[model samples]
Target chain A: MQGDERGAVMKPLRRPRALPGTATPRPRHRADRRPRSTLRTILALAAGGVVATGVALLASGGTYALWSDTADLAPATITAGSSTLTVAGVAEHAVEELDLTLLAPGRSVTTPRPVAVANTGTTPLAVTVSTIAIPDGNAQLAEFLRFETAVDTGGGETCDLAPFAVAALTGESASQPPVTILPGEEAQLCLRIGLTADAPASVQATSAVFSMIVTGDQVRVP
Target chain B: MIKRMSGTLALVLVLVLSGAGIGHAYWSAHGELTGRVAVGTLSMTQTGVDGLAAAFTTDVTEVTAPVVVTNDGTVSAPFALSFTGAPAAAEGTGQSSGDLGAATLVSVWPAADAASCASVPAGDAPDGSTSSTGWNAIPPLLGTLEPGGSAVHCVRAVIDPARAAPGDTVVVTSSLTSGIGSWSSTSTADFGQSFSDDAIVSPHSF
Candidate 1:
């Protein structure tokens, strides 16, 4: 029985015969016409444009640059302000030179050798003084001599500090600038040099070159 | 499919033209900053000065003379001063190295305008006072020199009575200069160029 039922379900079905007039139904009332029109062309073009625009916007996240440019900076001419520091008052020039010649223990030079610090530029600067690059081939003499700095600005101006230890006078690290000088202004420094009385005989003939350095850091131009 | 392709091509052309049109309105502006910095010079002078016009004699003690240094430039400068005024060929009859006698010296700057300078004692200045010239350069010192920063010097010139007899004469001079002197600077001098930004071409910012 099941085999018979399965054969019936699998049996092919046949279409009913169409009436003569219905066989070619669409042939009736047909006329000469184009499959596509100008309207269709316009519609296709619109669709493509929409798709292209959507893709562009989606890819770039709706961002576009109008105009951009970059230019390098022009070369600047920097007129460096000069810090003119000169030494004065010596025997070659006056009496100060003669007093500094002999380097004996307990020897002291109290005479003022005015070291003038000037800001010879169009700007102001913070000035610092250091005894740097002082020729010191003889370590003994360098260690034996003690130096100090004092200041005198014109009318009775005096600054006396403890003697700077020769050993402590390393690089420019020991310098301190407590003053600011404007352009065309100047300050005078009175230098004092001395030899340690306790220095041993080892430093007898040793010599050392001496100098004071005045550095200027330019201030904002007003 | 062909119609769609044609539409895509048309859209692409439109987008390209629009982009070109936007760029056509592109504008540009320029900004500029300029700097012209020239380092200034540091100079000083000490000529035709005096150490007490009271005259020079055997009885005078150490006194001070005033040295006034002026900076005529715009900036401050340091000067390496040296006492270059040795006796130059001795002038006339009073020209003698030991004529001024043995004397010790010290620098004294008292007050701004006043000096504690040394004199040639009582009596008369050297008969060749006009002949003795002071230095144009200062002794090179180990320090700073500010612009217009001036301090009067009292070059205490004290005669050593034990080393000299009366009636002798002496002549000396000194001055100041900026920087150290090698064989070149002390004896020689050398001499630069720049163009302004406003010279030519378009008026661009500087």
Candidate 2:
């Protein structure tokens, strides 16, 4: 190319080559001068990620519970029937109450005031009365006694204090009454206890023994 | 460059370890039910008395309440007896400790009168009384009560006097088993006179 004082005469300059693994340098842009904002954003994101992770861990810590497999147990014990038995098992209805109590002495009490038996059974039971067995020595009161069963649909049932063989307290005294119970349910029974006149002063007694035949099938135990 | 890479790797390692620790803690608390023990099953018996001879009678002179416990789950759950509504004058001791296969009875009633009865509590009771001779310290094992079966233990109740007069009756309350957070209803045993027995009383002369 011929060079003149004012005439066009220009040559291109060569750029340097990059070394191994080095990226070729380019012209600096406005973004390169202000990279602090992007670095700050990355650090903030890391911190937020850690905070979120900690919160998630806290929310799920040791949390557990059960849903099904709940079981209900029902026990039935018959005292003054043809057969004295107890039945206990798991059932569907929720058991409300099972209670037992003794009747006190009173003269006006007719037929050994009907023992107040409560029925907490989930389902109503057709309660019947039958003589189980007579006390070991009282073969005399056997003739004047008869038994009957009355169902109290709302709460419980009671045993008949009649003069039939199945009666619970036909010839019994008022002091201690007979026990009336709800089969397959929990209720109280009142028995007429005849404290013998020829008893010891301080007998440390345990439980009473009554030998009666069981006729109805209401006793259960699981 | 090396410093930047090392920092990132350390942070990742810490995060992974933290995650694992949280997972472990969670697993430890909410693990599955791993055990069950058959506590016991009770049988009922009624006997007849021939005579009414005493004022204060003891019905349960001997008792044998039995129970069975089994390990049904993968983990072990300890067992215990929780008593509710114990009578002040009641006398009786219960087995305090047991294992998967064995159980022992503890005595309670007829302890030198009502004062001695205080020494025996109904459920776990208090810890001040004399320790039972056998199976006293083992608080039911921490084991699974087999899913289907049970670990059995027997408890006995004995009555001192054979029979009581017409005016007296005895009330005994008890329960033989319990679960970790649930409760079984209290079982009751009663002894008293019936209608026919009342005839034994001498009639009032008119």
Candidate 3:
């Protein structure tokens, strides 16, 4: 009786028959089991790969932390150097009025006033006469005016008209080499101003007010 | 391909930024100065005119006009004088066929004052002398006058009996012009010579 009860409880592995007029049927158990097993294997592999990558990243982080070292440093103070240029001992960007009075036609007059360029900063500088600006309604007069310049590097030399043999127009750059000045050093600049003989009658009794800008660039020296 | 392209673009951006960071760096400063220049004026004026409006007679007569020239401008300038006019005869009068303007001789000379101008001898040419028929050439520099200075000049007109008729009348006009005579240097040293050491000290503050 026990053996019969066991036989009834266990079902037999057998293939089901197809309905009438149907094609040959596939094995449903085998096909469904194969697809489920393949999906579970792929999920298991993906989960294992993720866990292994996390372990590797943690190990790398732990290694870096174990090898790292730090040291304390003292505080440092830094101060920047300065570059400053002055004309006639005047401050930068300040308009220093120079006296060049009684300019006549057909004659050249050297200003009794001298232009002294001084480097009053902590660094050396290269100086250049950058620009000249003429006032309104004086363009005609500027055409006839000529200028010459010379530099005296504190050599106890007299600034005279001999150095002014070559002249240029007011709009043109002065034909002189760039002057290099050290800190606390000064250079004397002489200017000879002339009006051409062909200056017209209209320029008579007319006054021209103009400005000159000088630039200084810091130079590195060994 | 997209990953490779993105890596290449990142590299190019890094190179550009690095290049911009390597530009030159320096400190710069500037100064400015102003200059005022005044030009001297060259001009003159005719303050007064005398002796030019007189009538001439036939008998070798002389008339004198004292003209005054003033230097009105700021600069010293030299002056010159010129004359221009023509003689005309009255209409329907018996006077004709005579050139009184051509025959009339005019002379000019500088004098200390108007009163002294009359004392200048006739036919004396101090500055210049010309005929009244036409304009005279610009004469040599008569004299130089300083600013606001004046000088009296005598203009004498002489008429000859042989060249004038009874009804002939001539009017003369004189013009004065001033101009720059020459250029001179105020420097005592010879040109091209080294100048004396004259130092121009700059003020400490503006």
Clashes of 2: 111
Q: Which ten residues in a row have the lowest lDDT in candidate 1 chain B?
A: B187-196
On TM-score, who's better, 1 or 2? Answer: 1
Clashing pairs in 3: B51-B65
- Supply the TM-score for candidate 2: 0.17
Model 2 Cα lDDT, one tens digit per residue, B1-206: 44554566567657656766645211000001011111222122111111111122232223233333343332223343311221122124432211211112333221222233333434432333222322333233222332343443333222223232322222222333423322122222322211113323331111
Where is model 2 more than 4 Å wrong at Cα? A1-222, B1-60, B70-75, B82-149, B162-206
lDDT of 1 by residue, A1-222 (tens): 698898889878865567886764343333544445665777777777777676666554674659778899999898744433223322112223523344445555543344555555556665554434345455565565555554444623433443333322435443444456667776665555566666664444445665445455655555
Q: Which prediction has the highest lDDT against the true structure?
A: 3
lDDT of 3 by residue, B1-206 (tens): 34544554455555554644546788887887667666777767664453354444432356676777777777766776555554443457745424445556656666778887666676565654433422233243266788889877776666665655544454444556665523321101000001111243221110
Model 1 residue B27 distance off true place after TM-score fit, in angstroms: 39
Residue-wise C-alpha lDDT for candidate 2, range A109-201, written one tens digit per residue: 122333333333432222332233444334333232222323232332333433322235433322222233444453223222232222221
Q: Give candidate 1 misplaced runs (Cα > 4 Å).
A: A1-103, A154-168, A220-222, B1-206
Interface RMSD of each: 20.4, 21.9, 10.4
Q: Write the per-residue lDDT of candidate 1 for residues B1-206, one digit (tens) a residue.
A: 67667757776867755654434321111111111111223345543244322223344443445555554433344544334333222336645433432333323333335422334443224331321122223234333445567644444444454554433333343445543111111211110001112223221111
Per-residue lDDT tens digits for candidate 3, residues A113-172, read 457889988898888776666665589888877666666786534456436534344545
Q: Candidate 1 local accuracy as lDDT? A: 0.43
User: Which portions of model 3 show Cα errors greater than 4 Å?
Assistant: A1-80, A92-110, A135-148, A154-162, A165-176, A192-208, A220-222, B1-23, B39-42, B58-60, B76-78, B89-97, B121-144, B162-169, B178-206
Provide the lDDT at A195 for model 2.
26
Q: What is the C-alpha RMSD of each candidate to the true structure, in Å?
A: 28.3, 32.1, 17.3
